[model samples]
Target: MSDPLFEEDEVPTWIFTFADLMSLLLVFFILMYSLSKMTETTLESALSSIQIALSSNGANINQSPRFYSGGGSKLIAPETPQLADTQDLTFSEEPIDTEEREQVNEIANDIANKMVSSNLSNAVSVFEDGEKITIRVDGQTLFESGEAQLSYEAEFIFNKLIDIFNRYPEYSISIQGHTDNIPINTVRYPSNWELSAIRATTALRYFLEAGFRPERMTATGYADSIPLVRNDSPENRAINRRAEFVLQKDPDLQKLYGK
Candidate 1:
């Protein structure tokens, strides 16, 4: 009877303390996970996304993005352009596949043979540096002194060349026009630059008309910058004045050519 009915002890606040502790632990783990993958997160995410898209699981996600996004049956995607680089590239000092190398050589040889058999020996010459090939054409035969108009003989040669290019046009074609040191001045064109450009355009137009792939071809005018020999003599200058149709070599092979 010592007033026991009204007596009570102070209870410990354990429930609130435990909840706060649990919340702190959860936050610490989330932060650790984020820091661990910080450097490579975006890169890994992009690659994983691409891989998943290519897999069977992608079909489900792509068909119903809401399933993956999990936002009230709504799809979530960035509105801005994604910053990711995923380009296929190859790096090799030497030929990794001999079959590809052999095919290139065979193609070049076939072209060289065609040039010789078509009675274009004096006007055209084929040269091969490793797997790269180039067909040199005499501009003097195609142009009249300072003119860029194609002669009848040039038409025949180009006609045949067009057929060849249309058939196997996997190689890059460079049409570079060169000229002697002689200055040129005409009504429509002036200087070697304009004249050379006209010649390149003339040839390029012919190729395009003959159904050659435009992506693999380029038209350029070299003027008298690159000379085959000293322009001291008339014969040497004659050789310098030429138009070259070259097939490009692989960049790697070109670097290691004289090495």
Candidate 2:
């Protein structure tokens, strides 16, 4: 009655389908278990490794990751890159001049003396790096909590800075404002970015009013993105919130003005 090629004990076609279903379920459970064992840091590290591999293979990838807020449908985009508010000037490969290096050192010394004489040695610091100098002033000395308006004490310090900046006309100055990790939301400042920006521009305006050349200076806000220390403690947060005056020798300006 049966065909000659057919076997009486042959496997049924339904068995293959059942086996496939069981295999798929096993794989799904295995994947779920593996994921459950992975910590957040491990997952992030794996992702970073994948990104690096893809980058090495010449794949176009966005470095920033998308962030989502808890219980909110809104997407928090990464901060855009901001350029320094300075003129686009060409620089050569030549080494910094000896006199220029000395001048920068002298400026640092002068700033240090001024801070000590003004009894602000603790609240301010002066640093020199080759032909660049930075004067860092504590945020508390400049402005009140969550406020961009300069305090009365800030004027005296600003006056001293203006005198020094005027004396060194060949230097290009950048006034940078920085904040801590604390969130700020107000009618005027909806975020730390706006607050930091206003603070920087306020200082810039003061300098401009003091007869500093507008073309030689720039103002920018870092908005807590560049921190001096971790914001885990109040003391560290206080240190992170500050303003900096970065000065660099402008060779073109020096040549033009014969300084």
User: How many backbone clashes does every candidate have?
Assistant: 0, 0
Per-residue lDDT of model 1, residues 108-222, tens digit only: 7787788889878888887654445668888878877767789998999898788776555456688989876554444656677887888998999888887765766789997
Error of 1 at 233 (Å): 1.2
Model 2 misplaced regions, further than 4 Å: 1-97
Error of 2 at 161 (Å): 0.7
Clash-forming residue pairs, model 2 = none
How well does each candidate superpose onto the true structure, as a TM-score?
Answer: 0.56, 0.63
lDDT of 2 at 179: 86
Judged by lDDT, which candidate is best? 2
Give lDDT: candidate 1, residue 226. 69
The digit string of per-residue lDDT tens for model 2 on 1-259 reads 9797786787999999999999999999999999999976667666654543343112222223222221122322223333323322223245678887787788889989988998889888998776678899999889987788899989988988888888788889999999876556567787779888999999999998888778888999988787776666567778878999998878787986798
